[model samples]
Target: MRFLRRHVDAVYDALTVRRSRFVRVEELVIRAAGVVPGLVPTPQEIAAEDGSIQRDKSGLEIDQGLFLSAVLGSERCGRHLCHAMLLPRPEAQALLAQFERDGRVKLDGASVHRAGKAAVVTQDNPRFLNAEDQTSLDGAEICVDLALLDPTTEIAVMRGAVVEHPKYKGRRVFGAGINLTHLYHGRIPFVWYLQRDLGYVNKIYRGLAFADDAPPDEFGGNTIEKPWIAAVEAFAIGGHCQVLLVMDYVLAERSAFLTLPARKEGIIPGAANMRMPRFTGDRIARQAVQYERRLDCDSPEGRLICDEIVETGEMDAAIERVVKGLTNSGVVSAAGNRRAFRIAQEPLDMFRAYFAVYAREQAYCHFSPALIANLERYWNAQSRKP
Candidate 1:
């Protein structure tokens, strides 16, 4: 509540102008994120004791909370969707800086390809079916950064790499979720969760792309404020499924399914706890998250999460068609209307309220003894080393 008061006036001032609300909101976010350096640990700082990774933190820093409070608590921005609260200057610049560093580091797990106005960002870690490790997550972060910065990109597409395995043959995998092997050994860092929220997922939902660029209305820039389409080939599990909730459209293969194994893993599945209810309503979202129900893309509940399901090997055609159709109308108007719908469907306060519960509960989930027990029984992390 105190945080709300400190930032409310600034939010009001920004929204008073026509299309400048996003700029104002972003500046606020950048300032907030910048000040929390000590609170925000890097991967190394919070890795588990065994030199691997596991969920283990009752977080003290509230980066998400501070930013959301300002945006949602302010009567003006809350009512207006803060002009889509698109990428702020600091967040975009941070990703840009990381991109420079990433090329030299060469994670090589993610890439962005631009063809004309359409761009595709792919996860390429084929060995683990594109499961997120520190490096792949870093790749995902930079890919979104590039897509957000590229002014030519109209409709951004996110997909995964295909690999030939002795076991699976020629199948392409979208994402296998988190790298549980790392989790079992306690190598996964707490910072991964923070970045997932503030970096990529927030960037996608808020429509932020280029830092400190002219508003899309003034310069006709591509802010990723337009639309995002996700193509899921095999399965989206746990954190991967959480990611789908943020996408504007989800396209999956006929056999693809989504699941949140967070209950079994004993960790919160990113923002799924909050966003899932918006799509599947309260009862259904609870069943999936709490009971570990698998949602097939073709099922009624799955269709709610995935906008469309295509036959195997036909995802490419479907993506092209959707991108062409969405872009044919010109993205400027679409961006504006998206903001309007966002304000109506999800006010900032609602999301802000959710984080209050999430931040506290997730910390407990991270340190739970049950997490290790479940991994041993279900994943056999002790023997299989996965």
Candidate 2:
């Protein structure tokens, strides 16, 4: 622990130092840890609290806070500590290049529409119920970056694109979560999610992109100080449900249900582990994330995650009402207020350190034999056609 405590920053510093090549996830984490080492925990810590500084298990005492908690009380975008992980790296670049070269998609599965002060980000992959794939991740990154970058976009609303299938009519879904098909086939890269969570999703929560002189993590850079409202309907599955925890407010249809499905899927649920507890508290978060418990948007526990439950077909009106209501003050304190709340409730340092654990451990669970077996038994993923 002593050795790690001393060298942890050096490892992070060395790992994040500009390089021509992107390091492998586990390699980067382990190499950075040095002597008393461990991979970044991809799931929630097997046994650590959010702000906790230490833990002991398997006869090993571990502490990464010396380096990982650098974001606490610091204005620095937690990104600096995690090494700008959200930025597309080498593998991401190549995959995007190949996808484009094949003419596979014109849009990365996400589109942004602006009207007045609101920016609507539609996650459009109806074939997968708006499930996220590499393209979708890239698209979300682009859309979110666009929303944050546009000074006129005061509030961003995230929703899924219309589903083409007859089964669901034309109703939109918020998201279906990670693309299990791509994941089962090994097409979704680890960094895809890393970048999604740290890169764009955090950008949604933090409200800033690239501006050289924006004061550490300030929301400048031609950026708007925006708070996001999640408009959820139909299926809000897995990573879909996970992201709601980060939103400023959620307007959901009464018919909508939320679930992590992580227990069945055999991989991590992005940053849900870190942020879910803040909305639903520890017990509900555990039940939702660990047991695959489902919450109806109108339920008491669901209300904690969702601010207002609109009638089944009224999500559109609810979204407009909520967005207009929020911006009614028009003072632009949303960003500062959001920052204040996060600092008190779920500080960036705790999240950064949690990512350190999530980065390594989630990789293990992603490819574990148990994951395949769980999918076979629960999702029938073995027999389901992509």
Candidate 3:
């Protein structure tokens, strides 16, 4: 917990320094605060909000909360208070400008400090390797120095599962469910039918079906019957099978997660649709919708969906492959239409699998006193007024 707190404090300091690493934090906080609604605040708006501090002059000092509120606003607030406090900014505007002109952000010997130890992370902002950099590797390459505090190397490695794979290029895709689940299950006739038919039968079959090897009487019941019938009804009545038909539309074209049977389930399929496109291109959107198919590494469609699949059974190895691939290929080079889509899609699948495992682990594992204490502290702090 102390280590986590230190990371939070570091984020606050970095934001004040206007380091670009905090850019993500600033964006998150601003979005949480609902200060600008759908848009981000401009540099001018940020300056005005924070009492017109002179750019890069460092004269003004603001309370941590006030500074955060101004930059991130209230709408984007979240439980990750430390992250919200830090925002990433360009280290040097001149360098940024040059990168923009050259279509990349290149950094040299820039350090990412974590726990306490610092290691050379990379030599450059990998984004510099667009088609333009085909000949000149000397000027385009940049290096990074990473510092990890309290360095739990294993956890750091695990975290890379999310960070190393860009949403667009990875084979596994991860995403959260929209409100559609509640809408479908919580609605009127649907709820009644499910409770009466599927819920009751599933419970009874659990007790009796295995023992008798009999086809459970509740197996083909009303709940299943009605929604599917209703789906057809919906298509006829509303010109679509469901209010969230967009889910199916997205999954079929852009994602490879359909390779797993678990992902093929109706509810999760919708969530996959929403997240897949953010990683893949619009060209795949049409294909996903048209086919409503799931793809795997061995499938012909998988090749089209992702260039390479990290096939290691171990999660850590798979993630390492992704990180090495991205770093070596250069973030920018990997982010083109073809590669970026693959990176983006894999995480959604990984996250979905991870969460399922986590849920089961939570049900079985015991909590440490330190973890409980941290949870209590977090709840208490959240209970306090701002």
Q: Which candidate tops TM-score?
A: 2
Show how many residue pairs clash in every candidate, following the order shown.
Answer: 8, 8, 63
Off by over 4 Å in 1: 1-107, 164-169, 209-224, 384-386
- What ranking of all candidate models by TM-score puts the best one first? 2, 1, 3
lDDT of 2 by residue, 119-143 (tens): 7778899888899987677677766
* TM-scores for every predicted model: 0.74, 0.75, 0.22
| lDDT, residue 157, candidate 3 | 15
Q: Candidate 1, residues 1-386: lDDT per residue as tens digits? A: 46456755554454345435444433444444444444233333333243433434443234434444455555555534333434554444555555444432123678877755666788877777778876677667667767766666687888887855555457777787888777776655444565566556767775764434543333344455658889999888887888898788889999999999878887888778878998999998999889999999999999999998899889989998889888887887767776666667664456655544564455555556788888878888876554
| Model 1 CA lDDT for position 219 | 38
**Where does the lowest 10-residue lDDT sum fall in candidate 2?**
53-62
User: Of the candidates numbered 1 and 3, which has the greater lDDT value?
Assistant: 1
Candidate 2 colliding pairs: 40-357, 40-360, 41-357, 41-358, 42-357, 42-358, 42-361, 42-362
Model 2 spans > 4 angstroms off: 1-106, 209-224
Better of 1 and 3 by TM-score: 1
RMSD of each: 6.7, 8.7, 24.8
- For each candidate in the order shown, give its overall lDDT on alpha carbons: 0.66, 0.65, 0.25
What TM-score does structure 2 among the candidates reach?
A: 0.75
- Displacement of residue 301 (Cα, Å) in model 1 is 2.2
